[model samples]
Target: MDTIKKLLAAGKFDVVLNQLQERMLSDESEERKDALYYSAVALRYLGRLEEAHQRLDALLDCWSDFGRGHQELGHTMYALGREETALQAYYQALKLNPALYASWDATARIEAKLGNLQQAELNAEQAQFLQKQPKQVVGALNLFHEGKLFKAERICRAYLQRNPHHVEAMRTLALIGAKLDVLNDAEFLLESVLVLAPDYNRARYDYIKVLQRRQKFPQALAQAKLLRSDEPYNPLYKALHANLCSALDNHDEALSLYDELLSDKVGDVAGVYVAKGHLLKTLGDTKGAVACYQQAYQLQPLFGDAFWSLANLKTYRFDESEYQRMQAAVSANETRVEDKIHLNFALGKALEQQEAYDESFSYYRRGNVLKRETSQYKSEVLSQRVDAQVEYFDRDTVARWTHTSAQHRHLTPIFIVGLPRSGSTLVEQILAAHSQVDSTLELPNIPAIAHELNGRQVDRKKPLYPYILDELSAQQVEQLAQRYVDETRVYRSEAPFFTDKMPNNFRHIGLIKRLFPEAKIIDARRDPMDCCWSAYKQLFAEGQEFSYGFDTLADYYRDYLRMMKHWNQVFPGQIYTVFHERLVNDPELQITNLLNHLELEVEQQCFSPHQSDRSVKTASSEQVRQPINTKGIGQWRKFEAHLAPLKKALGDVLSEWAY
Candidate 1:
């Protein structure tokens, strides 16, 4: 490393570049990125612009968030006299890392040349901000924004080692950690930063984001409240405060906050309308939601999310003009990739409602392709996790884990678990409609526990979770159980039992069973093709990555069946499986059977689950608000010709669950 550094320092670019190129082949992501970055820099200096561009492009292809690579690519493009393309690359680099002074200066120059003086002025000011920070800190900020989390982490840690108590460095590292989904690290770092510099509003705002990402809603709310108190008129803080309130189910308060923000004349009023529309939709206020969505559309027609929100209502019908606008927005070159995706899905739904199945399927397929290109989901990880659960939780292992005398005997929790878009939400609504049960939004406490059990070990090869289950003490198991009940209390009511309808809880049934041995666990099942088809078409708010691809969805469904079957075997009669089709066909009989499984009296309310006016927060929210019916039962048949890949992937499940 010293030799190559000295060679570069002495202007021996070719010798050092060759050495760095060989080192770039190492297995370590961080090391390879470092070598590749240095090599690209050397290539530019050696006037090998083409080679530098190729190397930088390859680096960014692997690590799309690498802001330095984008900046270098911009430089190479500029040197090659492709100034227009270079301007875009610079903008991309700055989007991830705002502190890229060189990129900013280059962008400003290009924009000035293009006669975009206003944008050039803005770029010049951003460059001045970067000039105030240390060069190393600016580099770290750029890497952090570019999405090179590992590289950013390294730079921040190294800088912190030298500066020891730099708050900005700590905050930057925390932001990177949050981006990397290491919420615990981000939380601790942000907490430390606040202790050092309590007046740092930006860090405090980031702290709120980290808390929210960790599902610490109460903590996030408190942080947001603090920010709002500090800057009572700040629209961003006000909006965040309203969002946190909504998350906590304080809908009335959230609505008031939104109203207050909407009245702010200087604010981006259209965004609040969209936010209010979502909140209204969640509260089952369809008319008000539609009005708010329309208001947003009127304010900003190009905002695809507004139209998507209307279509996501599953009941919204688009007029011809709305349809044409969506089509134009989708075809427009200036429309963002993200907006185009939403527009495509909305258009697909609109066409599907009109019975244009072929065109609808094409739109849906296009949207998925666009989304899949950016998705980082890998099915093998999910497959391996399932395999580990099956291997680790045999009958003997289950019995051993539950052999301890201490147990939380409370049956106040009813978990409705299944694939997203299965009948889980419908089941939850039915149970919640019962006089003895209350409904909570899909609580993250259960999965949060599993995440906690998967400790913070840095090694990637070691299994940290189910394997560690064998080592848990009886007291620890009891505490984990009690902790879930305690933490989830915020989402409960005075009703004896509350339903947590987290569909993904199907993944962690073993931990759940060991914790609350008597808790009612309903395995909501639907016809495989219908369920997978619904999931494929739905654009979930978050955390259903498996449904984005047909192959992944099929493999996930098969593994889910395997896990549920294993659980049923180990704990016979413990899980109640409800077929969605059967439930839809014979509501009374199915409701009676479901109520009997829970040891509750059969109620007419359960038969009319959709009439309860409860806030359903799933893709089936709208459907579940209507009477039990078979409208969605075999809807997959309409797209049968386009479902060959799905049918092939589903294999046995499709055949077995055929109508």
Candidate 2:
């Protein structure tokens, strides 16, 4: 590869091509990707534009996110006198990687020729900024965009070691940290970058993102507001601010901002439409949301989020035309992996609605496979984590922890914990319908607290979290409880009791009992086949990575049961279990039992939770908006033939949890 590069630089294009072709014939390994890419470059330099285009097409077919491949395609298109096509290719290249200065330069030239002065100037400025960056920083940025995060982090850290306090390097490292899911480090690095370069709008934008990922909504919103205040007309800043506002429940302001962006007719119009559609969906305006989602897909035919949004409505059905377009989008090579994932899931739902069970299952499996390839989840890691928790939080430990004096006894947080798609959201809606109960989102406080206790460790074999509870003084435990109440206050109203329906909180019941012994814990239980299959079909925005594969999903369900049973043994009669099938079969009797367990008087409205008009954010948002029914009970039966692995893995849990 180095020799080929040297040959190309020496203007020996023919020699470069010969070397790459010889290497490709002998090497059918990953290096072939490099060979194909370099061959395209050689062909373009030799003025064999057609061959260059074909080579780039083949390269991108296998590696669609290769930004340099797209940039070379742009060059080939320009050499073939297809200026508009070249411009589009350049835009695609930069979209994959903004670090591609050559693409930015080409785009700027083309836009200038087309008399788009503002866009041209912006492109030129971006190219100039990238050009001015240190070579290490530039290379790190490229690696980061190319998904080589570890390499990027190493380069960034080595550079930062020599040039300490360099804000750009710090920001670059922070971006890599965020990608690696070390969000606390990312947040701290971004904060440091802003302190050094307070006027750096880019760093500020990054800071807001890290804060948002950390679930510090108020802090993220404050930073977003500052960014918007600095450039009130900047559409990106305005859109981000609006998103934060929506997260913080400032719905009116979020809607107004979306309207402003729409009326201005600038900056991600289709995306704005989708955002508005989501807000409208949450607000229960099904008609308005449908219109906005339709408008989005019409504006951008391959926009997969719009299609998925329509499908996620649960009640929406795709027409023939819409269905055909989705199929075409999935087949298109230009469609990105992220978009393809969405399209596959959307198509699966569409086919399922049409009762094409076999085809629907195929699409669902394809989507999950694609998603699993990109995920960092390891079943062994999760299994080991659960094992650690079970081993550490034994009955004796629980007895000692529960004896710790409680601080926020007044804050009776109703924790709805279970697997996703296990009717946890439905339970929250029911509880929220009670006049004395307030419903919050899947609160991250518990997981966030556990994460903090985990600290930064080199070996995963030795974790500090559950064990740390043993050392915590009563005052420290009380302080942690106070922090939970204070941080979550923004998500609550005046209701004496508020529900924290974070499904994954089942893993941390030990910590919860230590902090607030009186807190209510509800185990939302569902039939194994129904729960596992439901989770398998859904594409969660984040987390729940185990749901992407049948084996993993089954293993996770078993682990959940093990942990829950252990919790029950430790705190007998403390955790309440709500069977979803029973609730659907006998709504009145089940709801009465649920309320009675919570020590609350049953209200007539609890029977009709679907009419509450509160915003429901889960995938069941649409399902929970209607009366309870048995529609979802045996959904896995449709694809039972394909679920052999799930059944084999689930084993006895099926019979144990089956209704």
Candidate 3:
């Protein structure tokens, strides 16, 4: 220690670090562990988190069973922002030696980072039980993790009461307080964390998250500004600030920052470029948007959303040969089923258009198999959850619907519904292009309403009509309906009729009919397998567990089918099924029929949905932004060998759909 300190005092930190590295490579002595740990401390002081992760990883791999080695690696991984892996490492460390109480703190941090409250609490207790020495922050983390905010606050308060400077403990208490809806307590504790840490990354992120939740935008912005200044090298800090700016509608600033960021790119951040591309796309800069999206895809080869955006843009339309490259890019080592499915679907459409039906169908089948496994079972579960919720509301709101029908008026909203990725977004863009229709993004209110009525474990088969109808007083129905209207009204500027193109709204078809009978429900359908496969091949921003794995997604899709069938049976002829295949082959004819149903007199240019200067924000945005093309008809071919599970799970659904 003195040797390094003397070297550091002599302004030779670099030399000190270098000697430690040499010792790491040459020394088989136990002295190497000490050398490595000190070297890591120096690297962290230098703010070289990546290098630190590498050094720590090297030490841990060499001394695999060592508790301190694992703890050091976990800390480094956390600093490097690999939260999930950090938690696992910490857990491994504690298992190797339960007396390593420091692992608890790291595990707590990782659990919170991943938003796993249950696990966080468990780790917090582990910290308490294993504490060889109790400090001012004793038990606060565990209390907060357990959602016992009051007790957490007391612990933190007591810490501050004695030490009056326990910054980290105060911050931990404040974070929980804010989430627990005790804003005043959060304000007090966070102020303390900030004052003590001054530049703590954890405290800063927690503060911003809390402020954003409170909708204190200006304060959040200020904190964001401070964070970027304090943590200039942290890309995540910059991204969060950019996101906040976007949310506040400071597009010019956001765009400028994004533009600057693009000028000096980083690794594996396809999401940022995609965001920038979507923004450019919104501003009618299709060429620039496509360029940005291509950059994103180039950076992260297996990023499904990037490919979806690129495919959505007129990339392949301008250059069909990109299909092979896109396919190759998608088939990389880290290929996700969702990306592959979408790629294959896009490829199939491209090939089929080029008279490659056999190959196209091959892609289609591979994707279908993947789609079947991931979405099927989950879909059924969701339907049951919604049904149970509806049953609760039905028991209460039944009489209101009957009494309210006579007094209702002006129900002209168009719901663009169907399976996700079934061209709902495209269809809505076309309809929204009409002079009378406002094309809003997906509406999650229907599901939100359903969830609030009843939690998960819903019963779909039981008739909720009588009970639910009785439950909703006309006032309540009107209030709930009006809530949807109010939330959506912001997105509608001057269009006479607005479209809420939530594809999953198909599940709530009955509710839609009851609430707004006059509203048009356009059901967008692609080839059954194709639609399922496309969805399966994605890793969405939201919690879509089934989509990531094969078996779960197929089951989810089948449930969607089952629920839609039940919806059809109970409310016959309610939703207008717009086949994606039909639209792709004969867009003009289909659009005209769809318009006629919406009671809009056909304008000659509805066929040119691509020409409309509107931005499509969904996964289909890149593709739909361009002119309608037939390149995604059957995209399941390249990996057909691996799709047996999907076929087995979804054979009946595929057979019924004539695939």
* Predictions: Cα RMSD each: 6.0, 1.8, 12.4
N/CA/C clash count, model 2 = 0
Off by over 4 Å in 1: 1-129, 402-411, 457-462
User: CA shift at 277, candidate 1, in angstroms?
Assistant: 0.4
The digit string of per-residue lDDT tens for model 1 on 426-509 reads 888888889989788888888877866877652345558788887888788888888887777777777888888888898788
Query: For candidate 2, what is the TM-score?
Result: 0.97
Error of 1 at 112 (Å): 16
TM-score of each: 0.83, 0.97, 0.59
Off by over 4 Å in 2: 22-29, 402-407
Range of the 10 consecutive residues with the lowest summed lDDT in candidate 1: 402-411
User: How far out, in Å, is residue 141 in model 1?
Assistant: 3.0
All models: lDDT? 0.83, 0.89, 0.67
Between candidates 2 and 3, the one scoring higher on lDDT is 2
Q: Between 1 and 3, whose lDDT is larger?
A: 1
Q: Give the TM-score of candidate 3.
A: 0.59
Quantify how close model 3 is to the true structure by its C-alpha RMSD in Å. Answer: 12.4
- Top-down lDDT ranking: 2, 1, 3
